[model samples]
Target: MRTNILLASLVVLGFACQPTKQKEETASTPEKIAVPVLTKAWETDTVLLTSESVIYDEFRDVLYVSNINAVPPTAKDDDGFISIISTDGEILELNWVNEISAPKGMGIIDSSLFVTNIDEVVEIDIPSGVIVGRYPINGAKFLNDISISSGNEVFISDTGTNTIHVLNNGDVRSWLNDSSLVGPNGLLHQGSHLMVASYGGNEFSRIDINTKMRETITDSIPGGDGIVSYGDHYFVSNWNGEVHFVDTAGNRTLVLDTKTKGQNAADICYIPEKKLLLVPTFFGKSIVAYEVK
Candidate 1:
């Protein structure tokens, strides 16, 4: 009778230990799955002029790009223009809008398109591509990127000034005046915070619009130029031809690296509906698209 009891106790002990062993095995397993890097979904043929930046419009299903190079060799004009391309990588139209000089980063709000030039912000009418008005900044040099707030306030980065400025009703004020903001290139509005990419500092920062407090989330990125937010993740690209995916908690991992020469991955935009990422390469002279998945 005692031997029989020992056998039953051993069986119960084995069953209890089974769950612990399974738990250990499960805890040791890796949770992060490697996302497969995909080939370039599409690449536009070399345009007549060099392309400097790109932005995607999900509502219109179009990609707007800024071409800074002069088309005619002897035109004696450095006036920049915008180009509209389809998602399939076809140049739908060239010279969609002409007359803006050295247009760079661009953003759309409603039917209005905002573009930054050498020292001013030019607001253009979308369909017509006509310059409606211009906001000029004194002592401002190299207006790099612009982002619009829900309140209709436009935030611009002055790389030369190493400051971020806000424009409301033509009244300009310094939103962030710090040396760490040097070479601020891209701006994106996330919730009530403003995400700024500083190329000179090689960092990504989040600014509380309400409190005016700044927080540096990352400083390890090289050549940080453009940034965009998708869901809970923020994607930032460096001019060195690499893209980094960062989570809300400040964890970052390399998403993509291109062999394309020229550290000029100037701007990037995400189109959620199509799961597409639009990147404009300054040296590549072309816009490349990749599947977000």
Candidate 2:
């Protein structure tokens, strides 16, 4: 009887000590990322004169477009100007600010608007529509885009030299020169990082503001020009007239393709509150608006 009790106890211990049936390892399903559809809402007249970038001024409820009136983009022609348009696509002031040479990307800091030229960052007084300052970046080859950080520091990208220059408190300096820049064109300053759209490698990447470490989000976009955040995803435009919606996992979905139409998509802007996308057609000479659904 004691032996039977001992055997029963041993069996109970063995059962208790036995590992639970390991659940079969299953591959996790990728989170479903919704691809947004873009519907053409409005397009301004084709008189923008090689509009290269469009930025919305929320305070004024207007849109600012940079017109590189000269070809070869790097030309120091004095005809480049900034145009102002109403949110409803009406031309407010065709030459709100002129005399800029090959202006490309622009950002507004408080009452001042900063724009990227060939080797200089021009600061414009928004209310007065006057060019207040021009900060020249030394050794800058082709300054392409401008993004202002929360701290009001203006960051500019140079595609010709794979460099990034910064303007802080009237001081202009070369901030970064990484080979990984690969013709960085468009810059968007997020909270802790800057999103870069590369024209050479056809890549969209992020650079940590603190560490300066570069992380590629995708490399499939050809002639990447503009980048805008949409929730956790992004909307990036190709200089060849293709706009792609990129998910968190780097998967891209083509949202707009104007390549066949011979239209070029340059630096783009997104208005989250209205779910509106503003695309600058470089050669098309127009600002196209689309409602993203």
Among these predictions, the greatest TM-score belongs to 2
Clashing pairs in 1: 239-263
Which candidate leads the pack in lDDT?
2
lDDT of 1 by residue, 59-154 (tens): 788889987775431132647888999987899988888887777788788888888877888888887878897888888878878888888888
Worst 10 residues of 2 by lDDT: 18-27
* Candidate 1: Cα lDDT at 166: 85
Regions more than 4 Å wrong, model 2: 1-28
* Per-residue lDDT of model 2, residues 1-293, tens digit only: 99999999999988776654323344367668889999999999989999999999999889999999978788887999999998778998998898987999889889998999998999999999988898888888899988888998898999999998889989987789998778999898998999999999988998999899999888899898988889989999999999999988888889999989888999999999988999998999899999999
Reference-based lDDT, each prediction: 0.80, 0.90
Q: What pairs collide in candidate 2?
A: none
Backbone clash count, each prediction separately: 1, 0
Relative to the true structure, candidate 1 reaches a TM of 0.84
